[model samples]
Target: MNARQPCRERRQRRYREQCKIDFEIRLLKLSILRGHEKMTRATEDIIDSSRE
Candidate 1:
């Protein structure tokens, strides 16, 4: 109904975009960490098998 409403809506949109970006970043980091752990476990298994 006024100019202030448009400004408020713009700010809300920006905030939502920021949250989306942050969530994606977090997911990327978590997947990277999980992949690293899997690699480490695979290497350890290879070492164990070689020792036998």
Candidate 2:
């Protein structure tokens, strides 16, 4: 039981680090998608204004 404690702790720490990395990746993807949407909207607005 004593020897298993350290192993379990290490595994938990590794899992926590992986979760942090995944969260950051998701945030980056979301921001990129938002930026893409904003660019498309801006382009549409320009095209609409030109037609007027």
Candidate 3:
């Protein structure tokens, strides 16, 4: 099975790299969503304060 070992290792390495990329993308999206929510919430607060 020595011949197949390198192929399997290469596949595993590629999968790990893909997983890392996916994780970073997810983190970036989550942060963006959070920032958007924070921005909207702040705007709402400003509107409410101005009405009083």
Candidate 4:
């Protein structure tokens, strides 16, 4: 029973860590996508201004 308790705890801890890592990765990806969108918009504005 003692051995099982340790194993279960370890598994739960690992699962929590993995979840945290996944969440962080998703947040980073979202930020990167937003940056790309902003850059694209800025480029478009510059081109339009040049044409005018």
Candidate 5:
């Protein structure tokens, strides 16, 4: 085995890990946005019912 192969392998592993983390972050943001929208709808419903 040579030194260059190990370096290249390490870089590839790091790149894969970074990609996974980015994907997870995007999913988390999307879920949070959906939750916020649901909360807003619920609040609106309550306010609307109170006005009746």
Candidate 6:
């Protein structure tokens, strides 16, 4: 039973680490998407201004 306790704890720790990594990756992806959206908006504004 004692050996099982350590093994279980190790698994829990690894799961938490993986969750943290996943969260960071998601955040990075969201930031990149937002940057692209901003760039697209800026480009549209430029085109509109040039048409005028």
Cα lDDT for residue 21, model 6? 78
TM-score of each: 0.68, 0.68, 0.68, 0.65, 0.64, 0.66
Each candidate: how many clashes?
0, 0, 0, 0, 0, 0
Q: Pairing residues by index, what is the TM-score of model 1?
A: 0.68
Residue pairs of candidate 4 with colliding backbone atoms: none
Model 2 agreement with the true structure over 1-52: per-residue lDDT tens digits? 6989999999999999997976676566556767877545665455446434
lDDT of 4 at 39: 47
TM-score: model 6 vs. ground truth: 0.66
lDDT of 4 by residue, 1-52 (tens): 7769999999999999997976676566556767877546665455446434
Query: Candidate 5 at 35: error in angstroms?
Result: 0.9
Q: Candidate 2: which stretches are off by over 4 Å?
A: 38-52
Whichever of 4 and 5 has more TM-score, that candidate is 4
Per-model CA lDDT versus the true structure: 0.70, 0.70, 0.70, 0.69, 0.70, 0.69
Model 2 scores worst on lDDT over the 10 consecutive residues at 43-52
Off by over 4 Å in 1: 38-52
**Predicted candidate 1 versus true structure: per-residue lDDT over 4-52, tens digit per residue:** 9999999999999997976676566556767877546665455446435
Give the per-residue lDDT of model 3 (tens digit) for 1-52. 6999999999999999997976676566556767877646665455446434
List the lowest-lDDT window of 10 residues for candidate 1: 43-52
Model 3 misplaced regions, further than 4 Å: 38-52
Q: For model 3, what is the error of residue 45's alpha carbon versus the real structure, in angstroms, after optimal superposition?
A: 27
The stretch of ten residues in a row with the least summed lDDT in candidate 3 is 43-52
